[model samples]
Target: MQIISALSEVSDRYPALFVDLWGCVHDGLKPLPGAVEALQAYRAGGGVVILVTNSPRPRAGVAAQIEDIGVPDDAYDNIATSGDSARVAMFDGAVGNKVWHLGPDHDAGFFDPPAILSNPTPIERVPLDQAEGIVCTGPFDPLADPSDLRPQFLAAKTRGLKLLCANPDIVVDRGERREWCAGALAKLYTEMGGESLYFGKPHPPIYDLARRRLAAIKEVSDAGILAIGDGPVTDASGAMGENLDLLFISGGLGAVETGTAPGGDPDPTKLNAYLAQTGVSPTYVIGTLR
Candidate 1:
């Protein structure tokens, strides 16, 4: 893949850009260097920037985190998260309304009142054994091992409750460490023969919704849209599935496997092989978004 120094080189080719929020724009703790500048520059050049994230929290929740982390308001045109998409699905009656909320209290925003569910069936939160389905945002504790959820998943499997995974990211970088996500738990559930539905990156619904949002801001064909992200399983695969050009940023989650040096230099051959192994070939590769 060709390595680019700045997003400016290809900014003119696409009318819209779908950028990943966590690894691409920032880590969980703070905004990454030059990320905001790159986005501002892209919008200034007339490109519609939509921050597409695997975050299980709704737009409002994600926005709060973004604000707290100091991501400037003008960096992008809009934001969309897996939680927003999952809530839409739940509202459309994709899953039973009576569900168990499985993530931390911080993620309770996904199910709490004042956050209305449009279905005729009343939206209710029940105990795990009494629920018809489950909604998992992520691990209750980011530091906990996914294996710790196996017994609970087995119980759900036996009871035959559908699982709605708000985020399809298996893991994400949180400052200097990696944290397990809802997708990881969903994987465990599936292994135990449980039925699970995921909404987020690498999933078509979120991408389709994102495309429509981008179209609303500025009309652009899928080919005229560029997807920028750092993860292969989520971003690269999702972009390819949506038929959009991809810009893969190095030094994110797979830094070690890609032979990205501590100094921020990546070994091109190793990086390409890692993508190849995942069956993803990005249109371009850059060490950073800048």
Candidate 2:
């Protein structure tokens, strides 16, 4: 874990970056002090930066929300979210022709403007037997355990459904609540003989697409890309999953034991352990974006 306080250190090592939102850049509503400035500086130095996030909403919607929260649009080259990837899989014919919805009701609006499913949501499996596939947005019960959705998952599998997980996160922190996400359902379904294709971080397809997006705006390559994120699981895993150099921010996901430091506390030892366990190690580990 390399402790860096200056943006120059980051730019010298990696010219193109994939930065995570939420825990790494801002909370839901506010941007951190140096985060935006660091990003601004990174861009000024001939580097291309992309805000790659696990946001449940589509890429455009998530970008709008970030702009609303004050992360200057000029700070990065592009934005990609899990929801955006989900849109691709939802519409991609290879995935399936008909679909079944297994997520929150708020997500209904995403299906419009581009007809994802011919039938209105809460689409029955019986009708979907010959349809495209399954679209999982969230857990049937966010409050229930990860195993709670086992029954429906089995039914979906029995129907020979191809699963598309909109949110690759099994659990996410919404302020203080640890809510189960579509990833949990996907994992369970996979265990019960259902194959789940995830659309967010740690998945190579999305990573490659994000890189191409950056390339479109600026000259970029894999070696020059550095992924900075707050969580060892989603953000870190996403970067590592794609075999990119990574910087793990300690304060984002949970107050994981950061070595006792003022303004920030990140336990480098814990990070090492997580990296070893996941078979993915970050190139750098910092307490915060600063």
Candidate 3:
């Protein structure tokens, strides 16, 4: 993989970019340094920017959250969130009608029906014991360990209920604190014999949704579309699986492992080792989005 200093070096080659939101564009609390400007600059030159996120929040909710965190409206052309993708599956009866919601209040927007579904199945949030399936947005407490849900998962597994995972991110750095995400719970559930369905990064559904969103604006071939993100398993694997070129941001989730300094490029030796260890081969590498 080639290590580049700025996105501008390769931005002109791609007609569109599927950029990951957290870690690439922001740290959950605020926009990452140089990320917003790079996106805006790309857009100014007639490129399409789709904010593809594993956030459990719906597209509208994500838009509001990013704007609140100082990412301007012009930073990208559109958004495709995992929550919306999972919601479509949930309402299509991937999970049964009565589902036990295992997440915090902020993620309630996930229940909002998508405008695209003409005859969406009605979903009812019932208690775990009475539900037919589970819909996991995330843990009720981001700080809590996913193992803490073992008892609850056991009960669900015993009943043979399927779990629909909204976001497939295991954890995210919320400013300075790392917090668990829905993927952790889904991992635990699958480990405990409960079937877990994912609709986010490293999975097909979210990528399909992102492609549709991109096609709505402009028709860019897979060869001309670049995927940018930090997660080796999620971002890198997803891009590779889809046969799209990837620009891995070594300074995000793998900063420490790659020996990347804040707002700086990663040490080339460490970055190579980290990539080798993860078995991910991105087309390019950058310290930050800039």
Top lDDT prediction, candidate number: 3
Clashing residue pairs, backbone N/CA/C < 3 A, model 1:
none
lDDT of 2 at 221: 70
lDDT of 2 by residue, 44-131 (tens): 8778888887666777777778899888898888887777767765665535656777777777754543343464333323244455
RMSD of each: 1.8, 3.8, 0.7
Q: What's each prediction's clash count?
A: 0, 11, 0
> TM-score of every model?
0.95, 0.84, 0.99
Candidate 2 ranges with C-alpha deviation above 4 Å: 113-132, 259-262
Candidate 1, residues 1-290, lDDT tens digits: the string is 67777889878998889999988788889888888999998888888999999998887788889989989888988887889888777666556878888898888777643244543456788888888889888888878999898888888899998889999999998888888999998988998899989889999988877877777788888888899998889999999888889998877877787886532656878987888787878898877777
In terms of lDDT, the poorest run of 10 residues in model 3 is 105-114
Which residue runs of candidate 3 sit more than 4 Å off their true CA positions? none
Give all candidates' CA lDDT scores.
0.84, 0.72, 0.94
Q: Score residue 249 of candidate 1 by CA lDDT.
A: 84
